[model samples]
Target: MRWTVLPLLVLVPLGYVIISAQQSRESGESKQLEAAARHLTFGYYPSSLQQRIYQVPIPYGAAHVGYLETNSWSTSVLYVQFTTTAGGLDTFLAKVGTSRAALRSGSSEISRSQAREASWTFSGPGPWSGTSMHKNGDKPDHAISVDLHDPDAPTVYVVSTVNFRYGFRDS
Candidate 1:
């Protein structure tokens, strides 16, 4: 009886230690993710994960890229900013289903509210062009603004919104 009881006591503590370690590891991972989700991330090279998740076509050779992502129960928003060469800019525009001609001179389709949400300053370094493309129903919208001060290397800002306003589904 003494031998059996000793083994039981040892096994109980061992099992508890194993389970506690696993729980601690999992908790640490979740905490890191939560902290990352709470802040904006910036990089020269765009994150492929974010690009795929958001369906953003940030062209190759982009510089000074930055992004912020926000989510809710019903909506997700991706804000992207980058600088790209002239050809890269054209490619980006085409991938988003628009052309350079779609951009109107001296105007931005990005709303003040959207810019505020992204913490972006749309009022430029000068000479801006922009476009707003509303895709098919249920698809996200793309509103872009470009500071064409140096046309060869333009600074671009984009706001892509998925889903919709809370409690405002088009059903």
Candidate 2:
């Protein structure tokens, strides 16, 4: 009876280990998704706005080349949108593909190539209210703006009141 009980105890512990490993793998995947969403929003701006826009430093790499767009969707509200790409980050699609390929290729196989894309969005203070337009014309690659009245503060209050447009590439 002692010998039989020892085997059963080992099997139960092994089963728990397998289950915990699977859960850990899933949580990691979820974190990757959230990161992808945040990366897509960087340096995006909407078009046809009076405010001056400029590029912010990305730190340690070439700044992403793109446009910015800004528009007042409603009273006391503004919308900014832009699209840019950066290296050193994995996208959601790539993450999924890598996982699938790893399982299919087994332990010895490796991916030969990489992929990237431009993720776009409308991010700003105040309520976002408008139809996002995607037409070809003279527009900033990325767009972002501030709300004049959100009970927090005016968007232009903290910054200098001047129209400024410039670009910088980090090495």
**TM-score of every model versus the real structure:** 0.72, 0.26
Look at candidate 2 and tell me the lDDT of residue 22: 99
Highest lDDT model number: 1
Residue 22 CA error for candidate 1 (Å)? 12
lDDT of 2 at 26: 99
CA error at residue 150 for candidate 2, angstroms: 3.1
All candidates: CA RMSD (Å): 6.0, 21.3
Question: How many Å off is the CA of 24 in candidate 1?
Answer: 12
- How many Å off is the CA of 71 in candidate 1? 0.6
Shift of residue 157 alpha carbon in model 1, Å: 0.5
Error of 2 at 113 (Å): 28
When summed lDDT is taken over every stretch of 10 residues in candidate 2, the lowest stretch is: 106-115
Cα lDDT tens digits for candidate 1, 64-146? 88777787877788888889999999999998889899999898778998888767776767698999987655667789999
